[model samples]
Target: MNPAGDPFLEACSKTFEDQFSPLEVAGIGSFGIVFSATTKSKSHIDKLGTPQHRDASEGSGTQALQAVKLCLPGCPSGIKGSTSRLQAEIEAMRRVSKNTTPSVRHLFAELYAFNTSNEPWYSMEFILPGVTLQQVFDVASAASYPFPEEIVFHVADQAARAFQYLHDQCRFVCTDISQSNMMLRYPGKEVSVMPDLVLIDWSFWAEASDQTTTCAVRNLYNCLAPVFFDAGWRCSRRHDRDSCAASGVFHSC
Candidate 1:
């Protein structure tokens, strides 16, 4: 659907006083649709606060682009927890932002603002000039060029640190770990310089204390651990580690 005609976008425009101008759909899934938008006025940017890694060009009278994810009502088919899930995702982002060290925090996108009043939605930092690991793998596969061992290790090491923070400090488990969830910031940078790996999509994160099964399992068969296939196995920090390892192997193969 066109952004202008989308009900969710219309709601956002009305609710936020047209501060955000929708550019295009960044992604769409069963739970929500993420729109790439830019701030219409300086006041809006002020209200959301400046991102730490924003380029100098953006500060030079340029509209700052962001990602807005609007919840889809009654999502996940029969399930009706879309709004709650979105809230959880926002809370997780905020927790990580407040507690992690600078290096580890940069690995996760920053949350700007969120609302659950009517058409639930949230805005977050948009990674510009970035490429998902999935896209990189696809290109390499098509060209029959495997990524260098050093590059692989670099990505893996950064990802491992991020997961460790989420597990040990934040006490959360990113139930979803896949190639598409990891992005290489500044992919055009010199090969000698390792690009920062930014992890996205916290839609499936669960707190370590929560013993309940998660809906994330439904779509994460390839990355999920074998224990997840058991009848009543609950999510844990190990699940994320296993999933990360599986995703690494899957993408590198």
Candidate 2:
């Protein structure tokens, strides 16, 4: 589907016209379309309060860029459920922001603002000068350059810590842990050889539980833990860890 022509995008453009402008389609997914946009004025941002990891003084003079995820007119579920899901995603991020260790806090995006009342959507910190882990792997393959071992370990270590926080503090399990969902951010003016890893896309995350929880097994089959394949397996912390391990091994090869 043409994202630009999508009626939801048009509606969002009209609804948030004054607050945000230049909505460029960044990515499209089953549930929604993500737009990279700049807030027209700082007042709108100020209303949402200061973001967790960003300097309050950084965007005082200029428009600040943000990633906005707008739900499809009728999403994976209907409008009501979709709005609830988006709100839940924002809440999950907020929980991480509040409880996560300072060093690992940057690994998760900060929630800026959201509106579930009308034209359900939420805006978040846009990871500038960043590329998905999948994109990094593709570039390495194209250049016939061996993917660096240190980079793999770097990503693995950071991801492990993030997962531990989610499991221990939040009692959440990120069911979908894959290369495409992992982003590498180059923080400084000059692109660094070793970039920081940031995990994104919490749409499919589930609360950790000892009781068996039904998951989208088809979507998770490849990277899922071996126990998940059993007829009645319970969700646990190992689910994310195993998936992260499998993803690291599969992509780094």
Candidate 3:
């Protein structure tokens, strides 16, 4: 329960660990804490002299914006052991990255799995210039603010694309698709046509399996009832993850 004495931090010492400087707390999940970090590779640090004095450009590159997630055992997100679930997520991320087309792959972040002192964790891209759909909905509803129909259409299109890529291409289902699990890129911007959205929270994102049907139904309820309905939109799609695969579709793209 101690922050400073946490296993993830304790395991991370030298070996690229020093490269990551945690700037602030991102959010807390049932089992872990996330940090928005400024990270440089070992070579990047050597070139910059001090990791502390790294300029904005240093963190502006490919590995610049990253999210560090430290796992806690038996988190509510996992039905099996936390370690097993963490490994599964790493696999899922890779599948999406390697199996999908470049345009579709760019819509999601890359994941890297690391372990130190027998403690395992992963770091991923921190999607920014955006806010969680949950936060957006809660605040707007409280203020009785109604977003334009244009924004809704944008959101709908982007979400459909992301979900299709996951289901048909990645062969994974976002079994939990609540507002918090979705984000709208570039929040507060007036320009809206195709809503730039990204799906977050891989905890319940699983490969298409026998249990996908139940998960899909539950996910539809969690996602549809509150946000879409409140926004005066209706969306429904049948969940058939298994059948959606391999219509002359190779696992590899």
Candidate 4:
């Protein structure tokens, strides 16, 4: 808990009704506030949701708890229009989810409700118990940990599989495949990490099926597909290849 008169928390809390409290500022940018919450809705019985850990005896004990996410448009500084972008993202998720497989949580924009009557806002599922691979990498990198081939391969494999689905099946080229966009739905259960990884954030993507044009530029060291440097070149499946071998670090925003 913060101080009683914490203006930041108070301002954020006022954004939502009394039911859902702002648990924490998950991600803060010029866009808006991303909060993890516990809802006050009745009949919220605890059902056997997705498992995050696997039972040791059965060699499976990585089942995680459940959670909810609230996306508020506009940050404290009011630099960007989160409301409009939120709508676009939700619409994109809806269209993509219909064709995506259950294993790939690519289209997980399950909107619980919205409050457009007054101001625009976004409320959706809160995938819990599991964390993002970005978080895992942060911990390892912060400790100056060296990567084992198995771990690197495992993470890359999971991401690559999701990317394949997004490109091949969904026919969408996700220009932003950073660690922050990769979320874990269920952890150590019977589900393999390969498919459990949910690729999120389509703000910098191009949906070839829809023929949408994207002017977003992404040249980050980590998720930089070769075509990012091709100025004015549209995002397509052909650019995802790694044309050169470069050794460095990748960071997620």
Candidate 5:
């Protein structure tokens, strides 16, 4: 460590104001604990942050809700690879959001990362009034109803396009694809039209370098939430066809 310390280190330290209203737990996993919140002002939005989609008629004062993830309190301070992993996530998210397309721009939320030396956290566009695919399946199950296969396929179709944007335009791979990673924003709205689907989680996504090799980049896949069905899913993975196949969204893993 340097004697005077690095002044630029403070640049990574972020603080929140009353502008952000904390809601509930978005999720909890080895990756980190996610919390939901709402932004009170447009200024709160980071430089590369995604402004919440608002109807032009609605005019000004459009607040964007967002989700934030932080390391568990009890995590060891000097634990191996902790800081590096969080930094990696921030880098990957920045790269993906850098070259977003018109249709797939909303596929992932804008990342706002910070490192306060002792703790690390990052915020993303808060997806409100939404439910994950897992929640949808559970509710349908509890009601003794089947989750509409048509709606499922529609969401999958959109998600496939998102994957195409990620792979083709961004030179990135979504190593983790699953129902839990898929979020839907629809309520008091008809499902007749396709609901907007947002893909979350970038813990394992990799940026493909120009000198990418098979075993180094193309062959890797997330083993979590493996829900493979008979749609040539493995063939796509084995032959690196997954980079282009939009059909993988059906299995979602």
Candidate 6:
């Protein structure tokens, strides 16, 4: 961590203050800057995948107090297709928070209160000592290490549960499900050595109101339902099902 007394930290602190009327910036993301406070929180705007990161721990957290995602106001119009996508996402998140069941890992950080000081910023929980799956994958891949079957089964089960909850209970489809958004919990002495996976980031959640349009954007297309490609793809739930299935196979003897 940079020195708290460093000028950069002070500048970030000032940016947070100017936006939230006295909050401190805790971190930044591709879409906005995240600020923490005693009573409220705020985030500044930026483009998709534009939030910079110095490390991977930003992705973990199981409870509201564990994490937050501040969103930007306007998109380049050329890129977002519509400016209200962010706002729509916020509303979608509200629905998700209410509809979420206990068994599933909530894909979004809960909005405690929003900062209306400027643009559109909202405060949410902060994940403590949580790490993103992307980070774990990097370490695993870089080390050329193969995860044990038992560990893979353990982590994959958690992710599958989260997916099943979203699909069955919430009647929602996560438009984005990838390593980058999955998080690992804070370790405790009693915690299983098996890694825990938590779903995070709901910017691309799908609902009944959503149109049956094809998403060609790299973000939405890569993990899209195969039905998206063939239009007659047999297994409608191919996306999540296949990913989890593959992991399961890897874990099974």
lDDT by residue (1-253, candidate 3, tens digit) is 2236544444333223656765555675665556666555645434534232233335436345456766655345652355666566667776876777745543565454444236545445444446778887787667667665556655655565667778777777877678877777653222433446676677667677658845664564456345644744333246353553221121112
Off by over 4 Å in 3: 1-17, 41-64, 72-80, 112-117, 187-194, 209-218, 221-225, 231-253
Flag regions of model 6 displaced more than 4 Å: 1-30, 34-68, 71-83, 105-108, 115-118, 188-192, 208-253
lDDT of 4 at 48: 19
Candidate 6, residues 1-253, lDDT tens digits: the string is 3326744345434444533332345455445444443212213221112122112223442112324334543223422332244455566566667787645533344443444345434444434357776666566556656555454445545655656565556666667666566677644112356545655566576753234122212333243222122222132354566455443422222
Worst ten in a row by lDDT for model 6: 45-54
lDDT on C-alpha atoms for all candidate structures: 0.61, 0.61, 0.56, 0.46, 0.53, 0.45
How much does each candidate deviate from the true structure in C-alpha RMSD? 8.5, 8.5, 8.7, 8.7, 9.4, 10.7
lDDT of 1 by residue, 1-253 (tens): 2457767566556555466777676777567667777777666555545453344226576666677777765345212566677777888888888788866766787686777765545545555557776777666656666455455556656766777688779877777777687778854223336777787888777766534123333323343222122222232455565455435533333
Each prediction's TM-score versus the true structure: 0.70, 0.70, 0.67, 0.60, 0.63, 0.55
After superposition, candidate 1 runs with Cα above 4 Å error: 1-17, 43-52, 56-62, 74-80, 117-123, 187-192, 209-253
Shift in Å, residue 83, candidate 2:
1.8
Q: Sorted by TM-score, highest first, which candidate order results?
A: 1, 2, 3, 5, 4, 6
Compute the lDDT for candidate 6: 0.45
When 1 and 3 are scored with lDDT, the better candidate is: 1
For candidate 1, the TM-score is: 0.70
- For model 4, residues 1-253, the per-residue Cα lDDT tens digits are 4514745455556755555555665666444456665544432212312232112112332222223323443464452366655566666566566676656553243333444344535545445445665675566556655544433434444555555566577666665556576665554222454324555455456675433312211223344222122212222355433441121222121
lDDT (C-alpha) at residue 124 in model 4? 54
TM-score of 2: 0.70
Worst 10 residues of 4 by lDDT: 244-253
